[model samples]
Target: MVQQWDIVKIIGAIALPQMGGWVNGYLTRQEIKGWYQNLNFPSFRPPNWIFAPVWTSLYAGMGYASYLVWRDGGGFSGIAQGPLFLYGTQLALNWAWTPIFFKRHELKWSFVELAALTATVAATGFAFFNINKLAGYVFIPYFAWCSFATLLNYKIYKLNPESTATIEEVKEPKKKTN
Candidate 1:
């Protein structure tokens, strides 16, 4: 039996991360059929169909984990501040990566950003664990996914040198020597 306030908090918590994903998904959908389809991904890159479900699950889990932290740690004031701050930091980084990679086409920079995101997520997980073990446990898959994403980002960055080239450079023809 859950209280109305608890339900509201859970919904809010879950919505925040999912909203970020929705925005990022918008960016991804815009490019997936065009730019993303043509990009040079690593051999280990997962099938395109797999990403949405995995991400949805991870986001929901982390969001619930956050709610636990907020509830157990006594809201934003007191002990919740540090962990919540960490969660916020990681969420921002997570949101930033999609725009950087999908919209701006900055593969290398996105990888760098993702590496930072991975580290931040790990820190957030530890912080959440300190506050509530369940929160920390829920973060395990999120951390693992971030780690995998970071590696995938690095591999994609390496495989696609042309990703950095400007549109002008791509469209221009090279002259042949006699």
Candidate 2:
């Protein structure tokens, strides 16, 4: 049987990842301030401001799903841990992606990473469904967002393969006037 403290621990573990992701996301926003403003984003791109609220809600859902799994006790037996582990792994990857894409400006690598993250999240969702239906449902928005992000990353990479440079590098150029 799972105690309340166990539930708290699971929620805490899940929240830690989400909080880290949120902070990294904020930093990425700061790093890409002007870059996003200048990009040739797709027509399907949501307004820039929409991301904050969307992510916040998604993270909340993730946290709740974790709590559910944690409270389920033996409910997490067998392959149940699969979803939880994948959930955490994908969250970590997701958090790292913003720094790679925005801070390092590695659009190509970012595209690949985002694709992997999307696949992991999809797998997590499927695994979670076997453990808890609602838990799986909670990840839908997260999976959807990653899918959209993968498309965006690919477009950005295609649009500017040679544009992979740190913000500082992009701002500086060698003089060559003859």
Candidate 3:
């Protein structure tokens, strides 16, 4: 029923977003150089190396799930579309958090954003389960990762309350001192 080209297109669409998200995560790592060493992370926090492999697998699963949903068609109207949209939105939010937290160094803002991201992903997973069981299953790891990330964000925020100040405000003091 489905052509090979259609499958390719679906894979492309899904892969592009996932790739962007992957890149975003990597950029976040670069932006947060020395972050782990500097911060008082929780004992349960996984090592920095673990994030790469886990995220790589999660992104691959996301791409596959998107392909399955694409094969079904109907976009948002399709059974999987609801989850797809939710997934997409959360991914976009996920990408934004890196820039906010790492580049901007707004830990509190990042905390709020991560919370929203966690909630949206959970909702997406729930929606996906109602439509495609496999697709829903694929998102479980992503959801778990987000949950862990949320806790990390919360701890970071609490540990560094003043870290939330805007760049302009935080930088002004340094400029004056110099």
Best by lDDT: 1
Ranking under TM-score, best-scoring first? 1, 3, 2
> What are the RMSDs of all candidates, in order?
2.7, 3.7, 3.3
lDDT of 1 by residue, 52-95 (tens): 99999989999999999999999899798999999999999999
State, as a TM-score between 0 and 1, how close model 1 is to the true structure. 0.92
lDDT of 2 by residue, 110-133 (tens): 898999999998988887777788
lDDT for 64 (candidate 1): 95
Kindly provide the TM-score of model 3 when superposed on the true structure, using C-alpha atoms.
Answer: 0.83
Clashes of each: 0, 0, 0
Q: What is candidate 3's CA lDDT for residue 99? A: 84
Give the residue spans of candidate 3 off by over 4 A: 1-3, 34-36, 76-80, 174-178
lDDT accuracy of residue 77 in candidate 3? 74
Tens-digit per-residue lDDT, 1-178, candidate 3 = 7788877776786676667767777777686566535766666777777877787777777777666665554566766666677778987887788788877878888889999988998887777667667877888888888998999889877877766777788668655553
Candidate 2 global CA lDDT score: 0.77
